[model samples]
Target: MYVAVKGGERAIENAHAWLAEERRGDRAVPELSLAQIREQMTLAVNRVMAEGSLYDPDLAALAIKQARGDLIEAIFLIRAYRTTLPRFGATAPVDTGGMACDRRISATFKDLPGGQVLGPTFDYTHRLLDFALAAEGEPPLAPAGGDGDMAPKPHVMGFLDREGLIEDAPHDDSPPPDLTREPLELPAARALRLQALTRADEGFTLGMAYSTQRGYGRNHAFVAELRIGTVPVEVEIPELGFAVEIGEVVLTECETVNQFTGSKTEPPQFTRGYGLVFGQTERKAISMALVDRALRWEELGEDDSGAPAQDAEFVLPHGDNVQATGFLEHIKLPHYVDFQAELELVRRLRAEASAAQSDTRQEAAE
Candidate 1:
């Protein structure tokens, strides 16, 4: 029973004003520019874009700035703003196999086609923090690369396919279900599950993926390929009767080859788990792939170990940080009426028990 309480308009206004003041922080420090957040805090912006399901870096940076570095808050803002935009036509599926890769590597094979190109990465960096970064100074530039042939690299999984070692990827020309437009239905298709996982909270997804690695729903996975690069997006224009190249967007794609035992009607072969996300978010991409494989227990004819990662019902609903945060924070709101009702019930039960005890004592004395 929620009773409307009035007369806090002034207080509410003042509270909002105070919040704005706090968000601004001390006037002595220079205000952060959107460009700084976009360039310097690139990872943070990428996270906002990935989780918020919006591709615009500028808008993500603005949301981060407005939310005062609170990423969940930024995601909420982006999602809210996303609902207001007019619908544009959907683009063709990106050809990741033809990506102009900046970073590409394979864990399963020592040497593959399109020899490894280690772009900007933190894999070998020491954990030590550089104190010099605190001071504002221009860093030295990297040396120019030698002239080399620029061509699309072949997917590493192609090699495994030649030997019939891995299961073939299923091709579907039908349009996939849109979670943004439709409410989630249980027993979702792989495409829908992938959609939800892509926008899921990174921490939750990471933990779920880690659980699989730790023998919860163990799928012996090898990184067949992990590529980060820019891919062209094209949309078919009805008026022009042809597709035109729009722009390129950076994406990270991971394909994991997992061990699979042959089922009754199938030969033993490695299975695949795929993950693709906006921007250079390799961690999230890898996590998504692991969880993706775990959720494929039914399709792959694997035993249901009842792992949390394998349960779509359990994983999908709790994955969105925005939804989880909203439910949790709502408890901080006015629950006075509900609490009062519970209190009264408890008091009544105690009184009844006390009166019954007194009656029993009187009857015994008599």
Candidate 2:
């Protein structure tokens, strides 16, 4: 016998109320201010912005707080909020060549024009927990400086390009297809693929990239240059007749030089995979570059290695954690009708088998 349940709406409301109280925890502890999260949990804010495809720190912080530090949930909140906002106009492609670099390094060359700078990286840090941070006193501030003599740094790729040692990625003026607006189709363009990779789930992208490194696709790559800095954003005002600087956004960019094989028509030249992401996320940017190159095998005229990272069809759809999680978690929802049908079928099969076994046994005994 099946008894139909009711009051889903009321139950959901009560559950949400309980969840809200639980998120706050004990009333004795003071509620965390939004500014505290924005400043203290800077990396978390950056991840939310990068994944959510939004750059607002304050809003990202709020989402982080509201989501109770679940980064994917926070990203979901930020993305949902972003959909409601109206777009003004498109900004001109940011000139990363002229970025005011705070952290810049090159692995291909020992020294470069602007010189390698190691700024605020944990690469050298001992993993020991500094109990000092647990108490949290005002730490001494580092000296600030202006962008004096910040001439345009020549790209590491420029050196290879000048010598004709690398494949050329020519400038294209064709407008890219908007993935957010249109339904994702098979065999996406390079621009659309890049857009997906930029905001793709970090863990999924990282694993796929790692698979390539561990001999799946096996494109031996060197980090040509990695940079984290602020770049000016410019937007064209139709009335003004020209683009003007609107603001600046902090970004991390990675360029990887992958060894390539020459065909009869083309000479063997090093190829590049590029990644540019919001905030100072180096690992995600690097992983994104590796995956980007793997997906470009067809365009680069490389043999189809059939790696998961190399397959655009596999990589793009599973890259969004929100979509993947929703589909996976939805299994827990009410499936009474479906399960009941299966139950009946299972019971019928067992009864038929038991009757057949009894008939066989009786025949054998006789």
Candidate 3:
């Protein structure tokens, strides 16, 4: 005698109330402020902003706090919030060439024009947790030099381009297909794929990229250059009749040089894989580049190794953590009716088989 439960709305409300209480644990302790999270938890805020495809640090920080530090949930909140906002005119693509680079390194060349400004990075730092950071004290600050301006660095890939060694990525005026507005169709263009990658879940993209390095779809990639810096964003004003800089966003850009030995149709040339992410997310940026290269199997005249990273159909849909989490967690919801139907069918089938077996035995005895 089972009865269907009601009051789902009240249950959800009560659960949320309890959750809020738990999130703000220990009432004696001071509650964490959004500003503190934004400043101290900069990396987490950056992640939310990167995956959410929105640039507001304050909003991302608030979302992180409300999500109880669950970065995926925070990204989801930001995405949901972003959908409600009205879209104005599109901004012109920011030029990475004139970026005010804080950290820039080149793996291909020994020295470059910019002289490899390692502004702020954990690359050389020992991973040991510093106990000193736990206690607030005035730490010795590193001396800052350079006239507050880094010389405009020429792209390393540009040198290769000068020699006509790399494949040409010609500029085109054709508008890219919008993934949000249109339903996802198979065989997405490079532009659409890039859009998907920039906002794709970092963990998923990292795993896919790792799979490639492990011989799934090895591209023999070399990091041509990796840069982290701030770039100005400008939007055109039809009324004012001029473009103005709205703000600047910190970005991490990665470019990988992949060699293609030779193809039947095309001659041997260096191919490039590019990644540009909305924060100082180097790992995601690098991973994106590798995955991007692997996905270009068809266009580059290379045989598909049947790798998950190379499969656009497999990668694009699952790259979104929000959709993945929703689909994965939906199993927890009530499915009693469906399960009861299945259970009854199974029981009936088992009973019929037992009856048939009993009849067969009786007939044999007779």
| TM-score of each candidate structure, all chains considered together | 0.95, 0.95, 0.94
Question: What C-alpha lDDT, on a 0 to 100 scale, does residue 271 get in candidate 2?
Answer: 88
lDDT of 1 by residue, 45-102 (tens): 9999998988999999999998999999999999889989998889988999888887
Q: Which candidate do you rate higher for TM-score, 1 or 3? A: 1
How high is the CA lDDT of each candidate model?
Answer: 0.90, 0.88, 0.88
Judging by lDDT against the true structure, name the best candidate: 1
Q: Which ten residues in a row have the lowest lDDT in candidate 3?
A: 1-10
For 1-366, candidate 2 gives per-residue lDDT tens digits of: 123235766688899999899889889989988999998888889989998999999999999999989999999999889989998889999988898888888999988999887777898899999898878787878667533225678789899999999999835689988776676677888888888988899999899989999988976789999988889999998998999998999999999999988886789999889899999889889999999889889877789977888999999989988788789989999899999999999999999999999999999999
Clashes of each: 0, 0, 0
Cα-based RMSD of candidate 2: 2.3
- Our model 3 lands, by Cα RMSD against the true structure, at 2.3
Give the C-alpha lDDT of model 1. Answer: 0.90
